[model samples]
Target: MDLGLRGKVALITGGSKGIGLATAISLSHEGAKLAICARNLEQLEEAAAKITDLTKGEVIFVQADVSSEEDCKRAVEQTFERFGRLDILVNNAGTSAAKPFEQVGTEAWRQDLELKLFGAIHCSSYAIPFMRQAGGGSIVNITTSSAKTPPASSLPTSVSRAAGLALTNAMSKDLAADQIRVNTVCIGLIRSDQIEKSWQRLAPELTWDEFAKDPRHDIPLGRIGNTEEAANVITFLSSEAASYVTGTSINIDGGKGAAL
Candidate 1:
């Protein structure tokens, strides 16, 4: 199934590892030129090498923290400077800053919002003009399932992600005239770098396989999702295959989410 992404330029945030890295590889498989940004230069370099090795695709890595507006601008500018045009922007940079409702202080809330909400806002703002110049484009924002189905102890992330979903819908409407498509991929418990860290910290005695086994039973599919699974869906939304789709929040959670 050709996704019509050949020669298109894509910029993915938090592309150092996990879902972002997987998405970059997926898009590259569709023949898209890739630009990825992350806070850690070392990780970004490693990820770029891996993606290039797998797809033999052109990939550039930029070290930029998306929470900062200036960094967001720099990421977009760098991508455009190298690729000459930007067709897809994937807002996949964020962390799970979940805390109990009582523990979520004002500063915590502000920081999470800056990283998740404002990060997407800043990236899209910079990418829009270039996309318009290119005649059309796509923006895929990575959010969490908690945005739609609020669960206990899911703090700032839930609130910020819900805002992201709103932004996705609103931007889709506004950009539809420009031939730009906006969509969000709401995630569930996907096995990724972050989850690996949590598992190690929460249960140092258990091996990854053992730790994952417990939660696998909880998911309806009898297993957890992988980064590639989420990435496959994201690249679809970022390509012409989803030409008629916009303002939609699709869940990649293996039936873990309670809401529709």
Candidate 2:
């Protein structure tokens, strides 16, 4: 289907790997110009190369840690400077920081909030003007299902993601007048770098497929989700295909999340 993404510019944070990289590639394939940012320059370069090689589309990489307000501003500025306009902003920069409530210290909570909550805020704030100038745009915030149905021992991550949900809802209402649509994807156990690290650390002896189907993850679909699966919904929300979708949260959890 024609998603009406051609010639549009998209900026994806944490785009160096995993779901963020997958989303960039998907958007590029739909003919969207991409500006992807991450803290690691090497990963950013590699991801840019991969996207360009696959889609032969315009892809720029920016090295910036989204947790910092200054870095978030710079990332948006560079995207606008490179593409002249920003059509989509995917706030995907974050890591899992789940643990027992008591185990999460003040610094840990602060860092998690900074990266997941403030990161989205800073980027969206900076990107709004550009989106307004372009007439309209989309902001797809990447969150987790834990925000809605946090399990035992889920601390900082759950709290931080809950704030993200609130942010998405509030931003959608505030930006709808400007034609800027805001939404979020509540992800589950998706295959990504972080998951890969967990596999290596927890059960390096088992094959990936074996580890993923270990039955402990409890995904109703009986397996973990792939990065592309998560990316597809994100691309749709960021495109004209979902032009009317806003202030909503979609769970890409393979039926793992208990709450709607």
Candidate 3:
């Protein structure tokens, strides 16, 4: 099961918690150096400590808001400066900003696009040349299953993620000549900090396990997914194990999504 990730360098946005943190740990376990960025320095420091404690691998934290183009560029530059190269770029910075179309104001829509869509664009744009210089690399964009099958009340998040899917496809084609592979993971309901907060707000009476197994979610797996489950796929895609995987999207939704 050698993923060929030893000594490789990866940059993960929004790596302060949840799937991003999980992915950073997973990659580090495989002997990959990591640069993770988030807006919150305290959370980023905590995440870095956790990863270092768990894997004892090289890991750095960058404080940056991916929504800002300059921040995205700085994150990549800092990664390259520290790591000497960039082998993987995981566009994992985003929030599930879902709401009814009528309820989502113009500013909310604009902000969603900036963070989810342009964030990926800006980071990848800066990381590409470095990847090309290194001979080849991988880019894994974190999207949502709703991008393919938009459910009711899923506004800007779905639209923004759909654009991410398109961006992944186009980038794969355009970067293929340079030996860079682009792929995306479409997430389902996964256990994370945000999900825990949601559980507390919506159903504090039920235990966490009870809330996760609620049949109302309709997850075919009979429960919500864990962060490591999603991270495994992302780590694979970011490694040589998925060298031929590109321009495609994988659903990690336990068959909850309607589309193929």
lDDT of 2 at 99: 89
Q: TM-scores of the models, in the given order?
A: 0.96, 0.97, 0.98
TM-score of 1: 0.96
Locate the minimum summed-lDDT window of 10 residues in model 2.
211-220
Taking the tens digit of each residue's C-alpha lDDT, what string does model 3 give over 208-255? 899999999899999999999999999999999899999999999999
Instruction: Compose the digit string of candidate 1's lDDT tens values, residues 1-260.
Output: 89999999999999999999999999999999999999999999999999999999999999999999999999999999998999999999999988889999999998899999999999999999999999999999999999998888999899999999999999999999999999999999899877888788988798877776666347787666888999999999999999999999999988888887
Write down the RMSD of all candidates, one decimal each: 1.5, 1.0, 0.8
Model 2 gets an lDDT of: 0.95
lDDT of each: 0.94, 0.95, 0.96
As for candidate 3, its clashing pairs are: none
Segments of candidate 1 deviating more than 4 angstroms:
201-210, 215-217
Error of 3 at 234 (Å): 0.1
